[model samples]
Target: MGPTLATRLADWIDELGLTDHLAAAGLPSFTRDASGAPSWIEADGEPLSDERLAELDASLRDHGDDPAHGVPVALVLLARKARLRAELLATPAWTYDHLAEVRGASLNATRFWVHKQAEEHHLLTVAQGEHLLVPAFQLTPSGDVRPELLPVLEPLLAAGTDPWDAWIWLTQPAGLLGGDVPERLAADPEEAALVAHAATRLAQRVTASPKPRPRPAPSPVPPASGGCGCGGHH
Candidate 1:
């Protein structure tokens, strides 16, 4: 099990060198007791201001999403949920008419594909208010749907993520893609295959349990040598 929010907060306080600031604010130090157990913060006579709580809340929210900072999975999931909600809200919604126009296809044809091929082909659409928005990134410059998209989309949809959420997963930088966003990298066939494979793994993870798996460990940094590792520096 990971540390509690209080423990994390206390750690952050020390990590950020905020001991003096907290003291000046008349707040007790968020530190461990001599026995290495958690010590709760207590106000020194004066009540803690709402401003201080708000600041600490925001700080906890940010660090709670980061594993390196010892944030628990629960807080991390909360942060992720907030971010997904925001992404869905900020994402632009396009009408069927607009979608058909962008694809250079008749409305009827577009509707057929959206209704019929969407599931099989991995086309994503989201309902916003009264209209369903089709994310524009799914298409190539040639106005045809990117053939490579379906493979990645299939597993994500099957994994129970909504279209918008699936799209977010595709567009975000994937470690499996060597830090390339899946949507952009889909143009290259070899990379697209890898992207699709990675998407399947993500699908498995999404479907495996209600609780989110732990976030992937951060990549290790290469040690710096005096000269460039390549002879080019010579």
Candidate 2:
């Protein structure tokens, strides 16, 4: 009922100033139908299908709404993809089999250890499909989880931080760690304890803070034109 796909595509084309670029590339210019919805022509003289406009809209959604200032759209897409790849590499998800292989433990024993770590110890575990995933960064290359992690996790969980949030806090850059993440600091026992202490203080502060009570809703205003909106002024 709003702008048709073709119409939206036409709007984006103009907003992005793609007309001249397309022309320079020897591509056909966008045209409109009698109803003002967009149509297209191929680089050749042949007419393009309306489906092409819809496809164009679908592809553009991946770039997100903001066009980075003075950056090419293709470069924006590349940067976005690079950022995603970096994040994925930084916090890899470890499955039971992977952990078992790395730790030299039997699969059953690994599963049992993971359960105890998650439940009794409050280490972070994410449920992904039928598998439970732990962040690989929490473990050392020799395949043991960092000793300093659990103490921090205990305070975080006690303060009502969920496992996922706890994981994020551990991995996020911190001022106390000179802009290094807690996970990286956790490589050193003393630094890891410092991270835990910071977590404890944070949790304590949150636990000590007073919760705000909900405010009551305002009553409807009475009209001054010889009537109340609620008909109470009659």
Candidate 3:
């Protein structure tokens, strides 16, 4: 089954290690109802303060039936609950224009939809400028996925391996997540072999050439005080 809103929110918090912050904030942990909709409440079983509850209500109401919108809102809630200002600033979810470009869709409709999604998910704060930035987060560039792996993995996705499997295979070996390479390889034998083979080929290609020699040193000039003029001084 596809990831649920609660699961996605939990994953972001757990991955970023924000549990302590959430506890400190006194926000209730996220939970889902039988219908698969996510909800939260205060730890003391009392409703949140008027202002805070209103903010949360606004976020909940704004989301207007788009699955993609869940990703950003869950992320935002986790950030707010955990007080993870730094991480929030780091991954400002893609803006409306960014979504349009990536999805190759109409600008006006895409922006409206994206805005609705963000509102529903509570993923962003007030929109400003031409783009909306994540309230407290700043996004950094994720390096390109290894070029060789994309070809291999795209086919697997097309053929239909679970997305988590695809995500793990594409990202792990490149040390995107860092840590013991061999351990990761052992965990997934087939993918590990593919990555190793690709890496070996890439290495061989790069090292096959000899390093270029340094350019020849320039000739030195005589000092002005030297007696090398046409007067024939010895």
What ranges in model 1 sit over 4 Å off? 1-93, 211-234
Question: Quick one: best TM-score, which candidate?
Answer: 1
lDDT (Cα, tens digit) per residue for candidate 2, span 4-96: 655666676677656445544444457767876666766654565777655545555555465322334653444444454346445677788
lDDT of 3: 0.44
lDDT of 1 by residue, 106-145 (tens): 9988887777756664677766667766677776664456
The model with the greatest lDDT is 2
- As a TM-score, model 3 comes out at 0.21
Report model 1's TM-score to 2 decimal places. Answer: 0.53
lDDT of each: 0.65, 0.66, 0.44
**Each model's TM-score, in the order given?**
0.53, 0.48, 0.21
Candidates 1 and 3, the one with greater lDDT: 1
lDDT of 1: 0.65
Instruction: List model 3 lDDT by residue over 144-201, tens digit each.
Output: 1223343343344334343323333333344432443422443364665555454444
Question: Pairs clashing in candidate 2?
Answer: none
